[model samples]
Target: MVDESMRAALRALPKAELHLHIEGTLEPELALELAERNGVMLPWTSLDELKRQYAFENLQSFLDLYYQLMAVLKTADDFRDLMLAYLKRAAADGVRHAEIFFDPQVHLGNGLDLDTVMDGLLEGLRLGRERYGIGGGLILCIVRDLPVESARHVLELAAPRAADLIGIGLDSAEVGYPPSLFADVFVRARELGLHCVAPAGEEGPAAYVTEALDLLHAERIDHGVHAADDPAVTRRLAEEHIPLTCCPLSNRRLQVVHDLRDLPLRKLIEAGVTVTVNSDDPAYFGGYIGANYEALAEIGFTYDELKALAADSIRASFLPEADKRALLG
Candidate 1:
């Protein structure tokens, strides 16, 4: 149960979720529902068994199961239900705004078109605004482990609908497909009016963070926990006010860091780098945005620090300036 003191604090605060993956929000119950509706056969018969698989030796292990679950999501309605479920939980956790990521490669591999995925996601987001009053945006991320040509094709598709697609990001594994591999794709994305962001410093080195900024022109860095490795890069990021969307639990779960307290979060903040805590994948990573805050707070961040983190999330988001001000104010 949520503690009374923490519950009050969590409810009253306005939060912006900066690093969630829309597909990663697929809870087991909804997975079953979608599977049944689509007549898809899942390998697991029960939710308990599915939850057990969440334990991971590394990022690759978890990704295998993550991709396996995608088989159940094949239609527009499945995507809508996936997003609507996340929105409901996020609203309950006081998420005022969210910049959600979705991998088009995964959906397209399942024979789903970009329009189908966008239609469902946008429909759910519209319903979220009307019903839950949540402000949110979409970031179509490229699965970097795939061919660069695939990323280019996705970017080409996103260019025409650039208004709906606010940003482009790099997700999937970070070790092999470093930020430099997607240099051309990110350049085109930025030219087409899409903000560029990428996940580095999880399993990758500090060099990847530098490449994300220099080569990919990433506006923000996701999972930048290892920036502390290089004093010069850390100072440069801080000096430029580049925000780092740090996912505390995802770091711990993926073995990016030993523990929450062991994380360089407080250090990153102290170093002048803007840091925002987020639930990278609520269902797969174990909690929602409020749970992420609660986990960090338990490790001893002060109320003012929590507020700063919340504000940083909004500042790093792609929300319209007016909406950003309203959320922060």
Candidate 2:
């Protein structure tokens, strides 16, 4: 078990959160509050009903509820409130910097314009910096399960707001839709001067990681636990100094592994892979970045090892070198 001293240490350690989904930060209380404020009707009448649904069987099951809860976020204030709340929680968890993901495609499908999402998020980032002294930026994620043309359309829509985004990422269901399918989309995103990252080797095979690196030119791999399944791929990740943002709680909550001990974090770290811990969807997965570090401690990571993971997180983030150096110190 993690002692209070260790928990305090974990909370005090400065770190960067690289694989967070902003929409996934919607807690049940906030969801209900937004729903009622927006006059939107939800299937669950009470918080208990919503909390009970958090027991997900897999990624798809969790995603179904994830998208459903997004119905409450209708206005710019809702989005801004969402960002501020997440930053507040993340700040207390020792997050000095955060590169958060937002699914614009789903919001567009919800009859909202891109400006509502971008403006609100940007404003929230500005306020978060003032209030919590936390630096952050947005990563516009392409929902892979959607049509390829939809992906292309969102990029076109985001072109004007390119300056607001730090990167573009591919997320959503991973099994059937591979990274290769979105090569053109990523190519366009790169042309717009956006860094590329993708969710691979989560519910997909290790080969998807290779495809993401080769075809999509991904700079970072999110939830890349399965890369440990292939020695060659593992070697490539280590040799190239590519980073994997591993989320222990999300993996276990989604049943990617039946237990936290079954995760390949230690194997990847031992293989010289730059492994950094993150909270993928904290509100849904049951923790923030700090909780993830504590879970690693429970699974046998030493204090020095945890500190190394924190350093790796700062290195893997999209922050400027000077800012990273300041945080590292």
User: What's each prediction's TM-score?
Assistant: 0.97, 0.98
Candidate 2 lDDT tens digits, 238-258: 998899999998898888999
Model 2 gets an lDDT of: 0.94
Q: Pick by lDDT: which candidate is best?
A: 2
Off by over 4 Å in 1: none
Residue 61, candidate 1: C-alpha displacement in angstroms? 2.6
lDDT of 1 by residue, 156-267 (tens): 8777888898899988878888888888888798888889899888888998899999998888999988898899889988998889998888887877777788898877
Q: Top model by TM-score, which number?
A: 2
Question: Model 2: residues >4 Å from true position, as ranges?
Answer: none
Which residue pairs collide in model 1, if any?
Answer: none
